[model samples]
Target chain A: MQKLTKEQQDYQNFVKQKRPKPPLLKNILMAFIVGGLICVVGQVIMNFYISRGMSPKEAGAPTSATMVFLGAFLTGLGVYDKIGKRAGAGSIVPITGFANSIVSPAMEFKREGYVFGVAAKMFVVAGPVIVYGMCSAVVIGLIYYILKL
Target chain B: MAGKKMGLQTIRFQNPPSIIATSSIVGPKEGQGPLKDYFDLILNDNMYKEKSWEKAERKILKEAVEMAIKNSNLPYSKIEYFIAGDLLNQIISAGFAARELGFPFFGIYGACSTAAEGLGLGAIIIDGGFADNLVVATSSHYCTAERQYRFPLELGNQSPPTAQWTVTGAGAAVISSRPQNPRITYVTTGKVIDMGETNPNDMGTAMAPAAVDTIVRHFNDTNRTPDDYDLIVTGDLASIGKDIAEELIKQKGFDVSNKYTDCGLMIFDPQQDVHAGGSGCACAAVVTFGYLYKEMMKGKYNRILLVATGALLSTTSTQQGETIPCIAHAVAIENL
Candidate 1:
């Protein structure tokens, strides 16, 4: 076997010296603040839906859908992305964030006529994931149901 | 202006190459294994028979180009020119690949945006009548890139949340004269922008400004509103950068509310360990080639503006405490 070159050995030493340390207190604090904000938004939405007399299950469904829709809309209107810029993972970690992933492209191509631009290519970014997610969820749900039976 | 009077008509191609080919040899995921183990995985394999990083990239590029050409069913000799580049110091990957391919080559570097730049230029060459058939290819390997721009993979280092996964891949496309396909009609070159970011670890922040700069230029150069193109796609400006880009575009007084999409945000499962989304040259290449191409071919999209952005930074520069400088290149593709 060929011996490692001096450059390779030096690189190995350099990497050992530069290994990243754990996140500092400031990093943790920032994550908490940002994460809390996103959760607060979700809670407010749920409360609003419940106050409107919807059942808890129904409220949860609509609230989640609404968040996704809003995220997607903002992503399209180019607003959600702005919030995400300032908030980082705070904005990206939520379910609504995924909706933005779906709609931004659709909104972008609205100029090419609705069928081709809006309807066809809008989901280019998020389509596969959604399909895969839904399929997997269904399969998992069925398996759980069968096991229960 | 030199070739403008030639009345060079822009022609489109039908059945363009889909971005199914990729060359991603090294990255964070692959770095976890032992150096000897990883080297064996890369070198002992059929893919890495070449002696050096440059040679491996060239081999991958050649294969990708050949695959694209074969998939397009165009004869090798019919390809009028080959335009390409990489993130390497002198872009030797593209140069070597071009040399081996034996076609006229035009090398360019726009960091991760080289893929779009090459495609845009290839489109222009064909449209301008300088050539009827052209090939555009770009590649980057995590192994070569790490030594050039960051730490060696042997060291177990953690990436910041803001860091993007540099896609270990290469992609190629054939632009030819087939009237039924999408045609590259317009291109807007962007100026380099620096938002004063010095952290090499967080590229999204660094690249966001560049993406914004180029998107703004595309709007200005074409005198078209956001409503003109079906989608405005930015390359490699993952989660954080995508957000910043949207904000910057809004600051320009145009509402891209419904039309902004980012390639970096698309390629990976964020929950499955890809933190900020996929990046590197392949981020835009694979998504544009694999996902977008198929949809477009199915008559899903008519007009699209692909604006790929990049941060031009090296490890040496970063270690020296130099600021991150970003650039973006835009290409307009229309299906007639």
Candidate 2:
């Protein structure tokens, strides 16, 4: 956030004009298609659970768990990241991405041994999400209680 | 009073040291690149049977050094010094490799420019009669660099268009006083230049100015133009930085576009999908030692200016909102 001198600023502008911009349209399209497919798959799983005599609300938790398991499985098989690379927001905005966020560091750091490696690094990427998620949930819950809604 | 100095920031070596031998080892991805055939060893996997990527990188460096020494037809005891570096924190790759190699080690860190830096220093050591034979080596791993500088390998984030793929490889060259064809003649060291660029994902932009600065300085110091050399190659400026440096150098009254190219652009083909191209300590190292050196041996290029560029920014430095300071080291390797 420091102010750049005129020479630096001019050079930066020159570089900016040269740098390639990402394909926004293609990225958006890929994210939409891949994200939609993942949602459809989740829907099918939920419907299957409903047909098995479980209530829609009761199936929600299992559906998410199944999705998480699937995510972890695909990550272990090393397919999710390849999809994520091109899918961009599609692979990342889902519950499966949450699984991927945790499992990836776990696998990458496995060489450091189980304790400092797997266990320690498992939450590195996901830790922020979990901490912020819980904090926001608590704040929203307090607001909800106060508003009685 | 002049001594060995050639203009400011440039050194004219007396009795230039020759590159007796070189070796390159690349991972599966880089092995699939355009310069695949130039490499000495291509691993099927990045891990190379090692338990960790860091250890794999160390092994690659060690193998490259040993292979280069072997190729030089010199016994292990002949190499008096080992100058090595890497992109890893503490340069552990070179440090660990040196520990096993057991030569008088000089562990250096010049980010991606480590190869050229090592080569310049190694040449100086040999030319100065400090050592009869010495090795200059550098290595960089995509996995290690990613985890160290950016994100985890599994993070599903998209790399920007200007972002570069870290070349997973190691390159080593044996420099000695023995008369040889291609020799290191002059070294134009670079001053750290920061153009107030802060985007870590776009290192090409950050390092381009430094590359241009060193290139211009090299031209001024040596009183040579682009026509003097068959090629003027930058380390890892890739697509974006290459263009930027090309234009900036032209603006500085030197038109090297005809002979100019980059290691980053040479390593990967257009179909490789490596955004801006390749970047890493290994980028210049592998390309120069593998492709260029072999081509030089074939007498394809008489003189070449190898300007290796590096962005000296750590994860901590970027996080602290500091501008990336970049540098380039130019070494003139020619058929003498």
Candidate 3:
């Protein structure tokens, strides 16, 4: 094989030493705008549930669930990922992102058979997160209640 | 490119054998100038300001590869090639990292399964004698990944019970001509599987089918029972995916009950506020490289089947109303 010339070697070294530059204004602004839009959607869901006269805590449950469901649904439809790509965290930072985490994998494995395939594996990705989140919330809630008493 | 020898050459159908070497670098979760701060800086103040998503991703990836190479004990000049990918359009993070490495490079995309895909391919190239040494690396950062694929952290957005925290780390591995370690023996590539789950809120459900399909295919192609290996590991299936994988394996008459594990489940303590196990390409990469490699080196386990699975979904595809297609790649590793 032919050896690299001096200039070629120098260029290669330069490339190796280069560090990636940070993002500019345009990208951050877009992230903010898209992220805001997602938040607005969340507010809409919260308002819709509250309008039905449900307690704040109760309303949160369904709203969160719906967001999760919507995220998963979009993941199933392969639409949520696109938004994630364009808006970046705008799609993934919300409750919907969590839903996508669980449902997308479950949907991927449905053909293996319902018990193991559909039901069992349905929350494969999100299981731990949900469990921990629930456990932490419970623990914190209990501590608060005890303190109040 | 070579003279053809007509004689019958002994072609063995045994599994591919390639040793694994790995490295991981994690930023502080909480502290002054925490790792997240660097990410925030890139997200909010970098030159690629509008492209903070890509910029932070590139930064994280660069750090990951550097750490991985340092851990491998192989000089940068000795790395024959680099194979990598990520969750971005054009995989700029991986691509930019490769440009810095200046090794022969190939870009890949498998959402969370990228690290496995790179390792699997690295094994193929090395075992086939195409190269003497190669590096397979992958990474994901919370700030960068979130900005590119989810929401901004400052928005106070609440994650649902189904959500998984994308791992905020990077992992890299060096595959080379070391004969005193586990070798890659077999690889089973999977077909895209989508079960028509329309809910985007849950990914475990979406990714479960892909994991099951790959595991089943690995068993089928090798005609081996689950008992054949000391451990069966999956990439980023977390708690939900692990349970589903176990159930699916049972239905096929192959029980991985005691031997199965998932990378997503191993990375963090559940009480640490990391929701679901872990997600992202680095989930498997770091665990396999940092945890598994150390265990193997210590002779705690001898034979392992690493089945890294990925959901091939992009934000654009989801927005365009496409179905979530997923795939898994299996690599068998055994101590020789």
Candidate 4:
């Protein structure tokens, strides 16, 4: 934090005191319930795929694809955001939220047209995650190779 | 001849310019707000049949100006100048609106303080004999402002409770040399005050100090007190900033608690799920031109101090770790 003037510091303290805080317990409970429900849905989908004679390991990719499709479809339908508003981190921490993070911006910026709008802006929210995720995977792969050596 | 300049920051108009007519147009959300009846037009959709939110905002501003002129019984040619601003970058909403207006335009940017700034300058022009008739207008759109300032419209992130919703509306007023009931008496321009606040989300806290500073200066320069005006309204302090401004003003030896409120608070009902309240250039604009103007005409408030506050922080500045600089301009409107 930057250093503040005496008056600014005092006023900041006063403002902090006066500001209303969100209900922490209520939010936590909501996140738990909503997040648990999302996981249950994923589990059910996985079980359905497994029941169709696919091995559990083989069913994983399709289950994930199905979850992403659901997330993107719900976002297109303008319902995922409403769910996210109430669910908070519950909605955000899941893989579906990742799909939402991409599709939402794509839809929002579509007004600028196809090339510059939807294509360019689709990864804006998810760009950092993709970059860092790729970088870390490379680093871990190098470490694994070195350990084998 | 006595100078028009008051104590320090205020100007006392020798011949107060009158707000002869006003027009307010709002989106569906603000239409559902408590002051719905006061607005001249309420669109069923925020898009208003436009291709983009920016275009829609420009149209809203343009219509509001035309409607105000029509209400004033003044021909379009009679309007000497067009002074307007909006929350958009380059003030494009007002700039594009002024393009179609064909009047000598003064496209200004004072963030949310555009309404008061336009009115103050418009009044000065009329009172200074620069022009007889001018239209002062301001507008803001929620979708445009959201994408520009915070996040994309469809971003599923939760806003803090202190975060305010930007009002989607436009307000315009016809200021004339003709005598009328509600006159612009005094104007107090504020200095940029930074209280070391950096958070862009909590604008209320950042701007409260500036609002209080302007309010105190207005009273001091005009030799007036809280009793002098029936109401003292801030632009968009919402709940947190309004409370802070009231407390700070009291500390500065002015008791405006009973008479003070905010346009941010006035625009949206408490149960509207807008977190703190409504904000943006349109917040004060619509409330003043629509709700308060109608109330003033009905003799509910004989005089009022409209202190419009603005946080002068850009996304680049915020990203650069700079504190939010804030300003406020106070305009005294009295029925004489």
lDDT of 4 at B102: 93
Model 3 stretches astray by more than 4 angstroms: A1-149, B1-17, B29-56
Error of 3 at B120 (Å): 1.2
Could you tell me which 10 consecutive residues in candidate 4 chain B have the lowest summed lDDT?
B150-159
Ranking by DockQ: 2, 4, 3, 1
Candidate 4: segments with Cα more than 4 A from true spot: A144-149
- Chain A only: TM-score per candidate: 0.68, 0.95, 0.65, 0.91
- What is the TM-score of each predicted model, taking all chains together? 0.61, 0.98, 0.62, 0.98
For model 1, how does the per-residue alpha-carbon lDDT over B1-336 read when each residue is reduced to its tens digit? 443321222222223322222222333342332221311122234237666555676777777777777777778888878888888889888888888889988988888988788887776666556777778888777656765666333221335666666765567778865565666666666678766566776677778777777777667655778888888888888777777678768988888868888877765556535567667776677567655665677778877888888888877677677667788887777776
Which whole-number lDDT from 0 to 100 does residue B242 have in model 1? 76
Give the docking tier of candidate 4. medium
Ten residues in sequence with the least summed lDDT for candidate 3 chain A? A13-22
Tens digits of lDDT, candidate 2, B203-232: 888999999999899889879888999999
Q: What is the lDDT of residue A88 in candidate 1?
A: 52
- lDDT by residue (tens digit), candidate 4, A1-149: 46789998888888998899987888888899988999999999999999999999999999999999998898999899889888888887788999999999899888999999999999989999999999999999999999999
Give me the runs in candidate 1 sitting further than 4 Å from their true place: A1-149, B1-54
Every model: Cα RMSD to truth: 21.3, 1.2, 19.9, 1.3
* DockQ result, candidate 1: 0.01
Ranking by lDDT: 2, 4, 1, 3
lDDT of 3 by residue, B1-336 (tens): 222211121112133445545666444431112122222112232222334445556766776677667766778888888888877668888999888878889898888888778877787677677887788878776656664555433322445444566765567777876665767766666677776533344466567767777777777766677889998998877776577668767877888999998887777667655565677777777677766777788899888888787777766777667656777777777787
- Residue A69's lDDT within candidate 4 is 93
